[model samples]
Target: MMAQGKAIAVRRERVDESVSGQRIDNYLLRICKGVPKSHVYRILRSGEVRVNGGRVGPTYRLAEGDEVRIPPVRLAEPVASGPTPAGKPLPVIYEDDALIVVDKPSGKAVHGGSGVSYGVIEQLRSQRPEARMLELAHRIDRETSGLLIIAKRRPALTALHDMMREGRVQKRYLTLVAGRWPNPLQHIKEPLFKYLTPEGERRVRVSSDGKASHSIVRLVRRWARFSLLEVELMTGRTHQIRVHLAHVGFPLCGDDKYGDFALNKALEAEGLKRMFLHAAQLGFVHPLSGERIALQSELPDELRVFLDHLDRTEPQKHG
Candidate 1:
């Protein structure tokens, strides 16, 4: 147990297999009970926290057998705030010995951090503490609700990563955007660069010196002011769908980061509170078995309700 209000002496710990691949800052945050987030970053930036006698960035991934030096600081009083909370569990889409797929709802982060105490991964871990290994296979934005894959074993996780890199995994999303989609079938190839805003918020933009991204968008339907689209991602990049659509002049409805501000305000007045993006389907071969598998999740009730409202109020528009 962490001693509250007592200054801890500096200690060194060797990374083991269990902690390999986790970010250093996250590991510190978990162990340093009651320490403020700013302090963690401050220690990191000051080089007081060293890995193998050298300063490492916050995002540095830990490796097995790496020596981590932790400077002692006073621990905060034990607070119940950070413990995993009980709530409605995410709906399970598919489960096997190697993996588990769940339908993650919007507004829930995939993992805890950045002011979120607990998220889908943490909650799942809490719910199944007996399980030896469980990790995220991939991530969907917090506002995007749909099928999320969780690997139950390290081998399974590795297999999924290889599959994603090889483009064997197929993912599809449904979104409603601000303008009519011009093409029945459209392909967007853009380069995206990620950067932090002045306020420390992460953002992405199209840049010449950026990573290559590709998205295939098919028009699903059209309304008076918005068009529903089915987006198939060819290259997975940060904010690929949102950024691509915004660059193409069809920003996603209710997208706070890369959306139209005035239109978003109008949309809120019309009762659409969340981003209109859903990971509707995922297809990949089984990691353990060679069989092909496809999982799907229907639109959440709120999105469905908003779509119904649009259908009732806005007549279908012909391009």
Candidate 2:
């Protein structure tokens, strides 16, 4: 445990196989309990943190046997506000020695930070203290509900990352958008640039200088004023699905960012309280077994109820 209220001397750690391939920023965040994320990045930017006697970027992946030099920083003492919330067990979709997949609910973050005290990963770690290793294979937005993958071992995590990078993993989402989709199927290829607002809130936009992004959208159902779409991401970028859909003039229902504000307000009043996006399906090969793995999560009751309401009141144009 880290001692609070005083700066400790710098320490050096040698990477082992268990921790190999983890990003430097994430490694620091895990080890440096109570340290603010901004401070961690500050130290990284200032060259205070080093790997093998040289400065490394935050995204640098650790290799086995690499020596990491962690600088000293003071951590604030814990305040006894109340008892820490117990880690509630999430709905498990699948689990094995290699990984665990869970049905993550909408509005819960995958990991804790930036004003969130605990999230799905932290909750899972708290629940399974006996487990040797647990790490996120990928991430979905806090407001996006659906299947999430957590690796039980480092090798599995590394393998899963490679598979995703190679586009061997297929991810599909179900979302309700504002407007009638013209085509039965359409491919949206747009570049997305991420930037902070004047107040430092992260936001992504379609820009010429942004990284390439692609989404294949298939219309599932259409109402007089809304359309349900199945979106398959060809490239995983931040807010890829939301931004791409919104950029094409069909903002996702209840999406606060990059959404129709007036429609969102009306949606909240009509019982569509959260973003209408669900990670409905995932298909990939098992990292350890080399067997195929396919998983699906049905839309949550709330989202389904909203759709039912739409069907009851709105005229259906397509199905």
Candidate 3:
């Protein structure tokens, strides 16, 4: 076992084929077990870390044969049983040789990072240790639940990424906003710019200098104070639906970020603990088979129950 606080030598490692194409920070995180993320980033920014004898940003992808300078990092004390397996098995919606589609529950992240210890991918790996490759095809917010896809092969992962980038993938979400939806179908073509808050939390806002974003929101139902809407993304952007709706005066229910905080607090007291957003449907061509595939998931029980509560308390003002 490696001793704690021992004077360690700066070592250089050659990137291997197994870790190729992964971000440098991620690669370091995997090998530098127990090192704090801030410390890792600190070394990178201070030029202690190098790729081919030059400083590279955290997002740099590692290629085979690239030499990386690794600084000595003190590992955290290990537990009795090398860190307990993270997360649990989730409900699988569909599975094949190339992919695995699961009904992800709300409050669970797709992958672990940024203070999250484990997520869907980690849990799935723990459950299927024999599987050679497993990676997320896309990501949804941790507060959002529903159909999520995981690629089982590298080629499938690459193809899925291409499909999403070319706008060939159709992602549909269900959300309950704070006001009555005005239109049956509305095309929201607002550009979104990502920004960080004073506390370093990620956020997005509509700005002319931002990336082009498009969302089609169709009214599904309406109550006196809330409206259920189906949101389709024509262009994928971070927090696209949440930002777009909030900008147009319809913040999502239970959304802590870019939402009415007062209303959210009241919602929590009323039994809604999570954001009212879910990835309800996805349509795309199978990357390997060239077959059109469409999948849908029903509203989670928590969301359905909340909607029922609204129906019982607030009379419908619009359809």
Backbone clashes in each candidate structure, one number apiece?
A: 0, 0, 0
Question: Candidate 3 versus the native: TM-score?
Answer: 0.80
Model 2 clash tally, residue pairs: 0
Which candidate model has the greater TM-score, 2 or 3? 2
Task: Rate residue 166 of model 3 by lDDT.
Answer: 90
56: Cα error in model 3, Å: 15
Cα RMSDs, all models: 5.1, 4.1, 4.7
Backbone-clash count (model 1): 0
The per-model lDDT (C-alpha) reads: 0.90, 0.92, 0.89
Q: Give the lDDT ranking, best first.
A: 2, 1, 3
Per-residue alpha-carbon lDDT of candidate 3 for residues 18-132, written as tens digits (9 for 90 to 100): 4567789987887787788998899988889999999999999988799999988777566566755755578888888989999999998889888997889988888888986
TM-score of each: 0.79, 0.84, 0.80
Regions of candidate 1 where Cα sits further than 4 Å from its true position: 1-77, 80-83
The alpha-carbon deviation from the true structure for residue 267 of candidate 2, after best TM-score superposition, in angstroms, is 1.8
Q: For model 1, what is the error of residue 147's alpha carbon versus the real structure, in angstroms, after optimal superposition?
A: 1.0
